[model samples]
Target: MAEKFSGKKFSGKTVYSGITMGKVLILRKDPQIRRVKIADPEAEKERVYGAVDRAKQQLAALYEKAVKEVGESSAAIFEVHQMMLEDDDYLDAICHMIQTEMINAEYAVSVTGDNFAGMFAGMEDEYMQARAADVRDISVRLVRNLSGQEEVDFSAMEPSVIVADDLSPSETVQMDKKRILAFVTVHGSTNSHTAILARMMNIPALIGVPMDLSEIRTGMTAIVDGAAGEVIFEPTEFQCSEAERKIKGEQEKLRLLQELKGKRNETRDGRTIQIYANIGSVSDVGYVLENDAGGIGLFRSEFLYLGRDDFPSEEEQFQAYKQVVQTMGQKKVIIRTLDIGADKQADYFDLGKEENPALGYRAIRICLKQPEIFRTQIRALLRAAAYGNLSVMYPMVISVEEVKQIYAFVEEVEQELKQAQIPYRIPEQGIMIETPAAVMISDELAELVDFFSIGTNDLTQYTLAIDRQNQKLEDFYDPHHKAILRMIRMVVENAHKCGKWAGICGELGADLELTREFLDLGVDELSVAPPMVLKVREKVRGI
Candidate 1:
C-alpha cells in the first residue's frame, strides 16, 4: 500500500506561490560517500584536480543553460559556483589534506567539504548558511566523478512534487522543470537559492518545512499550497479537485492582470499614477519589462556589495549600473546607493556590533563617514548616467543637513569626472524618507531633493519602535497603522508643495487595500516587486 498516510499536514514559509496536487517524490537526503584506500597519493591528487575541472565544465554548461532559461542575473549563481570550485580556500584545504594526511582524493575532498560547510552553516546569517549547501554540492560531484558513479536520475518518474532536505542550483537546473510540479524542502529560507529558483520557475514551493520524512513515501498523493506554506499528505480526491479549482482561479486572476499591460495606469476618477518595480539586481529588469512597469523605481545596489570578500571595484559597480540603465531603455532607473549596515552586513565593512544597528552607523551615516567609498559609488552612478535614464537616491536620510552633505559629495564626484573629461550627466538625486525625523522635516528636505520615495518598511519599523526582524514583535509591526499613513501623506504633501513628486518603494506599496489611499494622498508612484506590479497596476486602473 506504499504506507498510505493521509490527513498529515505541516507548515513552512512560502518562497513562491501556487497550488500543486501531485504524487510525492522524495529524494535521498545525500548520496552515501565511501572511503577507499588508494595505491598512490600523487594519483589521488591528480584525480581530485581532474574532478575540479569536470565540475567547472559542468557549472559552465549549467550557467549557459540557466541564462537561456532564466535571466543573466539569476544565472549568475552558477558563475559563483565555478568561483567556489576555483576558490583557493576550498581547493587548498582539499589539497593540503591529501598531501599531509596521505588520504585518498575522495576522502580528502569530503573531509574538507565538511569543515568548510560546517563553518558556513554555523554563521548567524541565513544567506551564509545556504552557502554550506554549495560546498556539499561540489563535494558530492567530485566524489561521484572519482567513483565513476552516475548522479541520481529522476527522468523516468511521472510528474510529481519534489520533496527533499534541500536542493542546490546545479540540481535545480538539471531537473525536468515540466515534470516537477513544485518543491517542498525540510530546510531552507525564502532567500535561499532553491526558493529563488522556484520563484523563477513560477511554481509553488514550501521551504523549512517541519515534517517526518519517514512518514512520506513515493506514490502518495500530496497537496502543496505555497502561499499558505502548507503541505497535505495523501489528500482526498475532493480536496485535490478543490485545490485545482483554486489554482485555476488564481491563474485566471493573474491572466486578467496581464491584460492590463501596455495600458496607462489611471484611476477611475481620471488620475494617472506611475507603477514601477523595486529590483535588487540586473536580472530583475526582465520582470520590470514583463509587468510593463513605468520604470525601475528603486534599484537596490546593495546586492553588488554582498557575497564577496572585499568591496566591489568602481568599474565593477559602474558596469552593473550601466547594464541596468541600458536595459531599461527610456524607462528611468532610480539607483539607491549602497544601503549597508543593519541586517545587510559585510565583513569587509567592519561595522562593529552596535546596540541598535538599525539606528546606528548604517546607510547614509556609513556613507558620510566613508566619503571615499561613497565617492566611488557616486562616480560610477554619475558616469553610467550618460549611458541611460539613470537617477540616484540615498537611504536613511534624517535631516536637511544630511541631504546637503550628500549634494556636496555629489559635486565633488562631478568635478573629478569633469577633470578626467569623462562624459557624465548630473543625475536627478533624491533621498528615502524612512526615519520619523525625515518626515517631521519633510517640508525642509522636500525643497532640496528632486523627489521623495517613502520606504514604508523602515518608516513603520521606526514609528512603531519594533524590530521588524524579531518574531515576537511581528504583531506590533503594523504596516497599515494610522501613524504610517499619516506620515506618508505628510511627505507626499510636502513633496507636492515644493513642486516635487513622491513615490513609495516599500512593502506597503504593494498593498492593494492601500492603493486607493495612496492615490487619494496624491502619491505619484507605487514601486513594488515585479510579480506585484500588474496586480498593483490593476488596482490603480480600477480605482
Candidate 2:
C-alpha cells in the first residue's frame, strides 16, 4: 500500500516512479569574436579588441548576477567559464585576429569552433566528442550575447527531467538534482559527467535514447532504468505494477545485502574472496571503509584533475592520495595513475592531437609522453605509500615494451629519489589488462607486472569490434559475448599460472551474470560499483 506524505521516503521497498528523464548531456561552446579591418588598421584594431573585452565583461556580469541569485559556493563552478573567457591567451587569440589576421569577431569564433569541430570529429573517444559539444555550446552563447541578442534567461526552470542532446556543467548545476528524475539524451556515453552525476544522485539515466525531447510533454509519465537502458512512456497499470514489483524486490534484496555487510564473503566451499569498492575521492574511501569491503580496489586519480579547472599541484595530489591511504588504515588501496585519455582529460592542459584516439595516446601512453605529469603522480604514490599498502597500476597497457618502458621510468625516478635521500615507499606495480592484444599475451604480461586487473569495458568493445558509443550497435555490445568471456578466462588463468593475482575492475564485474562466471574462472578479487558490492558479496557468500 502507498500513502502520500509531505516528505518522501518509503521504508517497505524502493518504488522508483514518476517521470524520469533520459539522454541528458552537457553542451559547451564559446562564440566567435569578430575582427574586422575596414581600411584603417589601428582604428579597426581598437574596435575589435573593445568588442572582445566588452563581451568578456558581459559574461562576467551575467555570471555575477547568476551568483547573487544562487548561493556563492553553488555558483562557483559556473564562474570558471567567466574566468576562462578572461584568460590572457584566450583574449589575445581573439584580439590578435582582428589586428593581425584581419578576421571578423563573428567569423573568428566561428573559425575556432569549426576547427575544433573538425578535430573532434576525427577523434575516436566519446569523452572528447562530448567536450567538442561543450566547445560549440559555449561559443554560441558568447556570440549570441555579444551580438546583442536578447539576454538569455538564467532563471531556474522547473526541475523536470532534462531531455537534451547533452548537458553542460552550467546546465547540470542549474538543474535541481532532487527534482530531475533522469536524463534522456539523444547522445551520451558512460564517460560524461552528466551521466556520472545521475549515477551519483541515484537517478535513472538512459543514454543514446532513440527519441527527441520534442516528443515529450511535461508531466507525461515515464520509466527509466539505467541498468536495463529501458524507458517506458505512458505506461499502463500492468506495466506500472510490474515496475513497482521489480523495484520492490530489488530493494528487499538490497536490504538483505546490507545486512550481510561486515560478514566475510566466502564460498560455501569455504574459499574466501575479497570484494572492494573502486573509489576516487578521500570521502569515498571513508564511506566504503565502513562497509565489509576487503579494501579500495581502484583509486582513480582522474577525479582530482576533473574536479578543477587547472592541473592539481604535486603536493595537492599527494595530500589527497595520502588522505585515502591513511583513512583506509590498513586496507589496501590500488591506485590507478591518471586514467584520463587526452580525449578524456578535458582540463586546461592540452597534450596534443591524435588519430584513432581510442587506440592512440591515453592513460599510461599519454602519461609516458608527458613524463612530468606521470612522474609527479608516481612521486605522490610513493609519498602516499607511507600511509599504507599502495598498489600502483598503469592503464591501457598493450605492449610488453610499453610496460618495460614505464617500469624503466619508474625505476629511474625511484633511483633519483634515492640519490636525493628522500624517504618514500614504492608500492607493488601492476597494469590494467584491457586491450585484446594484452589479453592474448596475458601469460607474458603476468610475468612482467606485479598483478593484473581486467578493464572489461574496453576489452569487450575492442574484442567485439563494436563501438559502445555508437547507438546503432548499443544493442549488440554485450559483455557476455562468448569471445569476451574466453578472453577473461585466458587472462585469469594466465595470472594464476604466473603466480600473480588477477582482478576484475570494470562494469562487467558488477553485472550479475558475469559475476558467477568470474567466480567459476577463479578471480582473485572484484571491484564493483558501491551499490553492487553487498549484492555481489551476498551472491558469492551463498555459493
Q: How do the residues 1-543 of candidate 1 rate in per-residue lDDT, one tens digit apiece?
A: 344565678998787778878888887545566676666778888898898898888778778887775446557777887888898988888888777777788788889999999999999876677679778878877887777764556557688899988875546656777788999998866555576557545689998788888778877888999878799998777778888998899889988988988999897889999988888767768878887889999998987786444677788789889999999899899999989998777666878779988888989899999988898999999999999999999999998888889898899888999999998999999899999999999999988999999998889889999876565786666778999999999999999999999999987898889999998999998888788888888888887
Record all residue pairs in model 1 with backbone atoms less than 3 Å apart, i.e. clashing. 268-543
lDDT of 1 at 441: 97
Tens digit per residue, CA lDDT, model 2, 1-543: 012211111111111222243222222223235555445446644654555566566557655754654334334545655554555655565556555676556655556656656677668765455456545654565566546652333254445555566665556645445567667666665777775565444466666666545445445555565556566655656766776777777677657777887788788888866797777556455457545678878877886677444666778778878878787788888999998863476545565567676776678877888899888888878877878888899999989999899989988888977888877887989999889999998889899988999998888878888877665786777768999888888998999998999899987887777667788889888987565677788888877
TM-score, every prediction = 0.80, 0.72
Worst 10 residues of 2 by lDDT: 5-14
Point out where model 1 deviates above 4 Å.
21-205, 213-222, 350-355
Q: How many backbone overlaps does candidate 1 show?
A: 1
- Global lDDT of each candidate: 0.84, 0.68
